[model samples]
Target chain A: DTAVSQTPKYLVTQMGNDKSIKCEQNLGHDTMYWYKQDSKKFLKIMFSYNNKELIINETVPNRFSPKSPDKAHLNLHINSLELGDSAVYFCASSQDTDGGTEAFFGQGTRLTVV
Target chain B: SQELEQSPQSLIVQEGKNLTINCTSSKTLYGLYWYKQKYGEGLIFLMMLQKGGEEKSHEKITAKLDEKKQQSSLHITASQPSHAGIYLCGADSSNAGKSTFGDGTTLTVKP
Candidate 1:
């Protein structure tokens, strides 16, 4: 079974169009995260939720909002997307909030804004 | 804020040749992770190191953490085309599971 999965493996949209990406993890983890990988392949943490509680919120713009309905799901919604929003979004999950554990990542969603 | 810097942004090596990638951190790391990412795919966890001066090997890849906990290195022996991908090092300094990653090193293995 796929431990982590994200829907819409690829997405292409125009500027000002809003879109959402869904992520789910079946590893029975207590922490989930959202990351953004730019054209340079630099991965940055955007948000993290532990047991449905927001634990880490980087300096990401308000346009990017992450919602975790429960411990197993974390979804990202972008509002009024801009051209700069083009990047690959990844979903990850770990056993807990500890940094010593390895994180399982889902196949990323490639989002392109024109 | 913690930052990880990976050296040799990209590498090209012939098949059977060995290569090493280094990751340095700005502060003491509580945990370090090594991951590989194939083109157009997600990051795959390779190994994790928590203690200083510790080394772990999987298959042909081995990772080591420095005694200062401020640096780590990943070495691959007899690399093959199937090993080509971006190698990323992540550091957790705050123990919050918020890993900070370095710009990956792109490895290209020639046949």
Candidate 2:
């Protein structure tokens, strides 16, 4: 079974089009996250949700919004996508323990805004 | 605000050779993780180190967290083409369940 899965492994859309990427995890994790990997392979955290509650919000543009319908699903919606928003988006989930946390990542959705 | 910096952005090694990739952090690391990603794929968790001076080995890959907990290294022995991939280092300073990742080091093993 795939631990973490995301829809639309590849997305190519118009510059002004709005798009959404859906993610789900079956690991029964309490925390989930959205990360963006730019062309330089810099993976930066954009948002984090713990049990459907927003916990961490990086300084991402307002056009990007994350919605967690439940603990198992977290989706990202981008409005009026710009060229700068073209990057690979990854969804990850982790369970926190006193010892440490190990994250499981989805296959990633490659978004290209032209 | 780059918190983690991985050295040797990319490397090329011959089969049966050994190589090492280093990750340096500007602040203390409460937990450090090593992950590998193939082209256009998700990250695969390799190992996690919390205690300073900790070392873990998996197959021919070994990861070590320095005594200061501010640096870590991933070493591969008897490199093979199948081992080529991007290795990323993630650090959590507060153990807040969120991690800060480095740009990643790309390794290419040639036959």
What's the distance in Å from true for residue A100, model 2? 2.2
Q: The CA-based lDDT of model 1 is what?
A: 0.94
lDDT of 2 by residue, A1-114 (tens): 999999999999999999999999999998899999999999999999988999889999999999999999999999999999999999999985332689999999999999
Question: Considering every candidate listed, which one attains the maximal DockQ?
Answer: 1
Q: What is the interface RMSD of candidate 1, in Å?
A: 1.0
lDDT of 1 by residue, B1-111 (tens): 439999889999999999999999979999999999998889999999999999999999999999999999999999999999999999899657889899999999999
Stretches of candidate 1 exceeding 4 Å from the true structure: none
Instruction: List each candidate's DockQ score.
Output: 0.86, 0.69
Model 2, runs deviating above 4 Å: A97-99
